[model samples]
Target: MQIPTAAASGRSRLLTSGVALAALSLLLTLHAVPSAADDDTPARGTASMGSGVLAHEGVHGQPAATDRTTQTEGVDVSSHQGEVAWSTLWNSGVKWAYVKATEGTYYRNPYHAQQYNGAYDVGMIRGAYHFATPDTAGGAAQADYFVDRGGAWSKDGRTLPGVLDIEYNPYGDTCYGMTHSQMVGWIRDFLDRYKARTGRNAVIYTSTNWWQQCTGDYSGFASTTPLWIARYASTVGPLPAGWTFHTMWQYTSTGPVVGDHDKFNGALDRVKALAEG
Candidate 1:
């Protein structure tokens, strides 16, 4: 039998070591890669206003309003509430309503017609709100989706301008994995598109903490967009930069009638004025 040379044995060992090392590197890489399920992107059409807020910020006691003579009462609803009891809510003193219309570019609220028309039928000034999913699609695309779905505004005195519900991300990153400037840009895109399509500046629904964290408290939209601040407290605390006063306030998640409750900054006539605009 021929004896294998030392050099040949050394080369064989080196080759084997190289192969083993390569396999180990591949295995490590495979382990480091995240799966599709790991991405935590929210399912289409599932997000709603205050869904993330309620998850991040727990519920608080409904502060007693010494006098609600000037402020108008309202409610916001989503698919979670199903077919809402509009008459019950109206009887309970809700003068206005905001119904979730679309989420991202995929989910349209199935009960939008019932909730939106139901409120209007009950003599409540009603509006549609789009739950923004900034990560799923471009702002303009999502805005188009919203208007196409049910967020369109009309000259009717009962229909309020569509609302852009841009708040905490319930599925993943709080800012939907966007930087502050990017978030602001996305909002501007949506708002601009909505305005072009409907001839009305859309309302912005967001909490102070979320607006500050996600948009760097950018006040550019303040001059044009109506601010719908969400804060579950006795008082509205501090608002996002730029706005001296909130146009509307979402003050409670567990309202007496149904869904989350809100307050228009002014009286019923003012609510009608906003609807007319």
Candidate 2:
């Protein structure tokens, strides 16, 4: 048997060390890079109310104390909230709620019944909202899907009209790849179809910046459609061009409860009035 020289043994040790270092570097690179599926962006047809708002505007401090005193407290929830604690929320002074019902024509909240009915069971005025995805289907088609699923409205004095959550697109382009005119037309189609199906005007939920960018600040719907302006601030700030006032304001994404906090523009009685309508 031949004996190995010290130089040969040293060379072998260096080569082994080099291989181990390469493996360690590779492992670290893999750990640092995020996979496509690991993206926090919600899947298609699963985007919920304020999904884009939280992504875009981030969470702000609570609304002004004076603002809170005059307006009715509410919340908006999605499947992300799962089965909500409606009773706890009611005890927390939440007077109303909007539960996500559908998204485009592809997705519906599996927990819709629990959240929607649960809120009502707790003596809170509850309504459903549809997360609009114009790129997936026509506005009218999505509206039909919404109403069929859970967005339907009746003047039962405990339910408010459904809302069209039209804001920053979680999937792709900010305006869902449509021109300003096209975006406006698509929204009009959704609102008109929803009204035709439910005999009530669907509330339009959007941020001022998103409305300005996507719809060219169109004022055509201001007269008929109720606006639910999203602004995570102490005040609502400037509204979209034609809306002199917002019916509801989503004030904060990080509320103490299960979902985003909102405020009706008036007292608790006004909220009941909106429900009656």
Candidate 3:
């Protein structure tokens, strides 16, 4: 999608507000990748507005209000971040990064190789995420596509497992036209295939509202799947059925780092363990 740029002054103000709000949410509620190809780019999409701004909101049309806070063990990035200073990020205490590698079934972040490997080179635990496009393809098909591109992983201690970004559908139909049971099956297909392929379950990224609205608030995955909850609130609040606690909490959309700010719910050792099998 072609996002029209506003006049320099207005654009600057909007972007600045977006960045500031994103950072503030962190201090207040806490908070909250990648390069792709020309043809592979998803139409710049925005999140449904309500309580808090989606990290991926703004930039396409206008800047979004973001949660701002401090404390950054991890961050997720996509093409929107452009060129990142991985070493700088590492030096500033960013130990882990989740980079956007694939979306739907075909779109691949052309910058996957750079961001994924660059973070690894700097000794940071690195992982890649696939934006689910359940509306466009079945779960297994998209899982296969993601693994082939960005989901592939190595047993190295610093390489994190693949992630499934299953929040809002950027295209249309937030639930992808699937009923609650169907949504559960679709996610199960993706998760099961991913585990079979890499011998590790993919981490789930989503908000409580999205999960409830789309998946009927299924908690079955809580026993086996690691939860990465996104909420710009002081506390995580009510979570999906199965998850007792979030393994990761995304607090803000902007931070000292280049992407959305995140916390790994534990110490460096735990983060390393998460990175390992």
Clash number for each model: 0, 0, 28
Cα RMSD (angstroms) for every candidate in the order listed? 6.1, 5.0, 17.4
Q: Which residue segments of model 2 deviate by more than 4 Å?
A: 1-35, 38-40, 66-69
- Cα displacement (angstroms), candidate 2, residue 220, comes to 0.6
Q: Across residues 68-110, which tens digit of lDDT does each residue of candidate 1 receive? A: 4468889999999999999999999999999999999878899
In the range 91-174, model 2's lDDT, one tens digit per residue, is 999999999999988898999999999999999999999999999999999999999999999889999999999999998889
Which candidate leads the pack in lDDT?
Answer: 2
lDDT of candidate 3 over 121-232, digit per residue (tens): 9988889998887888899998999998878878889888898888876555667788999999999999999999999999998888888888999889998899988876
Error of 3 at 184 (Å): 0.5
Give candidate 3 regions above 4 Å deviation: 1-72
Which parts of model 1 have CA positions greater than 4 angstroms off? 1-42, 64-69
Measured against the true structure, the TM-scores of the candidates, in listed sequence, are 0.84, 0.86, 0.76
Ranking by lDDT: 2, 1, 3
Decide which is better by TM-score, 1 or 2: 2
The number of residue pairs in model 3 that clash at the backbone is 28
Q: Candidate 2, after superposition: displacement of residue 242 in Å?
A: 0.6
